[model samples]
Target: MRDEALPTVTAICRALIEQIDSGLLPAAGKLPAERRLSELFDTTRITLREALTQLEAQGLIYREERRGWFVSPPRLLYNPLVRSHFHEMVAGQNRVPATEVISARQVPASPAICAHLELPALSSVYQIRRARRVDGRLVLYVEHYLNPAYFPGILDCDLRQSLTDLYASRYDIRYGRVRFDMVPTALHGEAAAALRVAEGSPALRITRINRDQHGRIIDCDLEFWRHDAIHVSVEVPD
Candidate 1:
């Protein structure tokens, strides 16, 4: 007897699962509209819906009445989560991650950033503007201010690489913990252009504070992620 082949709906679901695992579908992300997917897969509406229903039942996908389907966020089963380094997170998933250092210069830390980083008045800090991309799609536009006292001439280093690793290996300083506050807000003016979204579009603004082993704040970064492209997850322990 020959081994049985998987059902058509199962095969469709498997294809989508492969895309998600490969980063082509993104994590905790919205799926294409049904019409688009039907065309892409050259399948009828009924078959597509059946495949989607099966995927949803398996907890691999979810559907919002008005928003359609989206990939479920990665399960955070255990560990309250220490510090999450963006560089490491992307690398672990085997994604093509790259960064562009838009600008780096010495500037007085803004009052807001200074307050977040807990710096002295009029302190000279190194500011870096960067855009992070996964597979050539812009994912995050970040503005980071670092204490010059700790990482001198950090602006000269290749920021496209991992800054966290650089700080650890080159300066013997590593981020011990971090705090994040995220909100959904409308983008406008320059921020809209950098993120390639229309003005007043919803965006996720994340303010992150990184602390060193001594519990001293090292860098305060503001990250803007296009709301349409990201899916935020909060775990509810059962």
Candidate 2:
């Protein structure tokens, strides 16, 4: 019985793949409801769902909480060394990019944040949280800690704009040297909820520290990205 069912499953999978490839189901397009898809595929719901799961594992589809599956978008290429803003890089790839400022406020730095910024314990730092989207898909959530001494009244500026541009125009500050450390980890807490992904989902956590030309630390950033939404590439010179 199982052997006979294998061919049916394979057929259903192939038909769906063909639809996706033919652009009938475009990237970011939502798949039909499971019941409708089951009927269309002329297969049992269990069998149809199994096929969908396989497609998801293959990086062709993704599921959202309380939302049906959608065709996965092409992964964004990220080059850390480029020094380009997020919007510019996404635009270079012909994709629309957007950023949302969740919140910005002055806060006392924690021990870890202080250490990263080389500030005294409990020093004031401006904390900014942002969510970035590509082609209408939320892909990254970031928390920025700025050394308040270097950026007085920085919170008054528009937080939705690119920080790189703001730093140059307002404070004559440009990034000098950046240190990046990335790790594969599970996202949790506010970051997970903001990205609309399940807690403990696989993600990449990247920490970046930026310094000024005088070697003064300007800010530290923590970014959480969905594992499937980005590809990191860097050219190393020997």
Candidate 3:
């Protein structure tokens, strides 16, 4: 029985691969219902699920809670060294991009935030939480902390727009230098919930500090990205 089932699983996996390669299952396209797929493959539900799991492990497919499986979209190319904003980068790749502002408010800076921003303890900072999507798929959740002293009326502006542009237009604060630190981390709490991924799922955490012309920190950003959704690339000049 085991031998027979193994061959069936292998066949199902190969067939699905062929479908994906042929564009029948286009990137980001949802797979058929499990019952229908099982019938088409002439296999039991358990066997069909096993086959799907194999494809997911290969990065050809992914599942969302209660949303069924979908063909994994091509990973977004990201260059941290580039000064372009998220919207510009994604549009350059011909993928639709959007930013949703989750929350924005002024908060007293915590010790860690204060240290990062080089501000006095208990200084007030604007905390803005946002989620970014590429091709309608949520890819990143970010929290931005800005020292309110630099822009007194910042909270009155639209927070959903490109912050880089906002800084330049509203406050004449252009990006001068940036520092980035990246680490592999598990999605948790607000980050996980905002990205719609399960807690403890693998994610990439990026911490960024943007400075202005005089080297004053403009904002500190914490970005959580789906590990499978982005490909980081950097060019080094010799």
Tens digits of lDDT, candidate 1, 68-124: 787755432211253446666666666666788888899987788778888877777
Off by over 4 Å in 3: 1-14, 35-58
lDDT score of residue 106 within candidate 3? 95
TM-score of each: 0.63, 0.86, 0.86
lDDT of each: 0.73, 0.89, 0.89
Clashes of each: 0, 0, 0
Give a tens-digit lDDT track for model 2, residues 1-238.
3666677778877888899999999999999999999889787888887787778767788777778889989999998999888899999999999999999999899999989999987688999999999998888999999988889888999998999999999999999899999999888888888888778867889999999888889999999998878899999879
Q: Worst ten-residue run, lDDT, model 1?
A: 75-84
- State the lDDT of candidate 3 residue by residue for 1-238, as single tens digits: 3667888899999998999999998999999989999999898998888888788767788777678888989999999989899999999999999999999999989898898899996698999999999999888999999998887888788988999999999888988899999999988889988877678767889999989988999899999988888899999879
Write the candidate numbers in order of decreasing lDDT.
3, 2, 1
Candidate number with greatest lDDT: 3
Task: TM-score for candidate 2, please give it.
Answer: 0.86
Worst 10 residues of 3 by lDDT: 56-65
User: How much is the lDDT of residue 225 in candidate 2?
Assistant: 90
